[model samples]
Target: MAKQEAKFDLYVFHRSYFCGKMMAYMRYKQIPCNTIYATLDKHGSDIASNTGLRQMPCVRTPEEQWLQDTTPMMDWFEERFPQAPVVPTDPVVGFLTRLLEDYADEWMWRPSIYYRWHTKEDRTLYKKLFVDELLGGFWAIGGPVSWLAGKLVHRHQEEKFLSGDGLTKANRKHVEAVYINTLDRLETIFQKQPYLLGSHPSLADFGFFGSMFWHFSNDPTSNRIMQERAPGVYEWVARLWNATSTKLGEVKFDYVVGQVPEGWEPLLRDACEAYLPYLSENAQHFEKGSKRFDWNVQGFLYPGVHVSPYRVWCRERLQGFLNALSESDQNRVREILEPMGGWKPLTSNAHIQSNWDPEGIAPLCKPQKLPLMYKLKSRFTGSNHVRTRRAWMKD
Candidate 1:
């Protein structure tokens, strides 16, 4: 008899965008995994105890190791299961794919959050969904208690997403406009090819699955817009969601190495034009000890956006990846990015701290400055020895 394969334990909720992305990726790769729903009332404590953080879409490896952060998780899994490579082999194409993935991961978050929680229709719908998923049948106990709990959850998310620095009336139009533009561009791509890169799904496709599948395709208002305006993209979301080994096996392996499809250029250009500038400005402000910063993209002003050290770290990671590429590969990528205004930021001489922590539990926008004593101690004992107790505690 053959030995049974060990299945990965995934801690997630059905309606979470990040979780959807992870699910799509794992299913596409034909990885054996089982879902463990992290309900707010029942399983929330289990997740917190396991990871020391409340974030969802965490993975417990076959070896009993816990992992978070979708990007790193994807990388780790790819190394372990090298049969289906989501990352492109060509350096230039790989760099571009990573850029798109990063843009989808960070920049698209604003619109995703806004479209999900800002509108009354969406708020009412998701409140029920959240309550049902988190509390299960607890609403049967008492109407008032269930209603109050649902209302509190809705209000908290509304304040965080709609009223907070993430989304406001001033920038709402800009965010929606960006989303529409992205959908239009993506529709064109899906019309030409099944996936972003080609026949086979890549990191770019899964990156988009995070927002498009869970929020835009699931939320009532956004789903209507997606179905009406960009049915191609909506269908693509469904396809990614239901992807499996059998389905993926039917796709011909026809993706040419080092070739990016023409449809992707416009979307990539928009990312470079809008998100790159925002990231560049945010990094500058973060380094200067500013807690809040903002920037304008395509004549739309976004004011009072909080400085995120985590995002700065993301930018630095991308730049570091570019810098590490061979000169020929760098030049090749520059040719692709230069016309879109991305080359400068991608190759910027910005000072990135070497000792910065990439822990997911770190405060999203808080400065990651080390105390003088800790900094001095790190020099002698190596930076890894520096304690991140305060950072974890902040979350």
Candidate 2:
């Protein structure tokens, strides 16, 4: 068979979390993809016209098909182009990979955004790039207009991410500790192996890689911390980027079939302990039809954070993965999770079906454009909510 070319046009800002994740994934797969900056002024209308919301990392395929949401997009890619598969065939391994991916996708987002906006050095540089993405297409580039746009964007991020989500002077140190713990765990894993799974960069690696490669490794403050503390993890970022699917055949994928890598236990522990409970809380709020709810992860409270219908969908997906397992595999997986206090949240609610997107159309869908006047329901809308509030009609 000829080497297939899957050329895709990607709309993304260089510093975006999911954008970097998708880019890294494409590079590893050796897919023909081009990165097009999805700046607010230039591609804002294009994004609004194409996908569910004004979000970055939207994909336009060679066939002119539009895709949003990395989780489903990657799964679609794995099915459409099965060359050098990243998802393992072993049922246990595959299930664990999806669980880890879901955790990385939904949970790590808070700390990832926090590092970019909360830390002074990272914020100083990132704020300017952010303003340009939002207002650069306008007539005046840098004076008073730029200043105001920056102010609004910065304040919105600080509120929505830093304060709104939950950051108290009391729990601030604890939040930083969560990020550091991840770095230390990943650093240890990288020190032992080339990737999170085995020889190949599995879904687990790509899931974490989106935030690690984009925000932590590149931003000034977090980058410095990663360099000083987790050098191995920093190096793995580049290693995974440099790897290609065709080249990975050189390494043998030797495993005991069902055993999760010992090195991955800490990451799984964190996901079970931290990520699952957070999902359960969000699911409760969505079930109650409440607009906002308290977030108490590991006993640290982030009260009154807005409820997310999207995350309820995420929790539902995780539950599906668990339920799809074979009876024996489920029992073994339960043994691993129950000790870590992970199993309850996944099974506590007998029925967890989020009616957010009932038609099963995601990544590929008919356009459903919301009125430009309406605020985007997704939290990671690049602060488009604030931008629309003031600069609704373009800067």
Candidate 2 residue-wise lDDT, 85-120, digit = tens: 777777777777888888887777888888888877
How well does each candidate superpose onto the true structure, as a TM-score? 0.86, 0.91
Model 2 stretches with alpha carbons more than 4 Å out: 1-6, 250-254, 375-395
Q: After superposition, how far is residue 274 of candidate 2 from its true place, in Å?
A: 1.4
lDDT of 1 by residue, 1-395 (tens): 99999999887888888898998898888889998876645665455455444457878767666676788678878887887688777787788888999999888888887888788898788777777775555542548866876776666666544565646567779989878999999999888877886678888889888999889998988899999999899889888777775666644434555656568888889888988878888778877888776667787766677677767777887887788788998888888788889888755757854234546432221224445665443222112223423233223
Candidate 1 clashes between residue pairs 3 or more apart in a chain or in different chains: none
Q: List, in order, the clash count of every candidate structure.
A: 0, 0
Error of 1 at 164 (Å): 1.0
RMSD of 2: 4.6
Q: Report residue 133 deviation for candidate 2 (angstroms).
A: 3.5
Candidate 1 structure, TM-score to reference: 0.86
| Residue-level error in angstroms, candidate 1, position 224 | 0.8
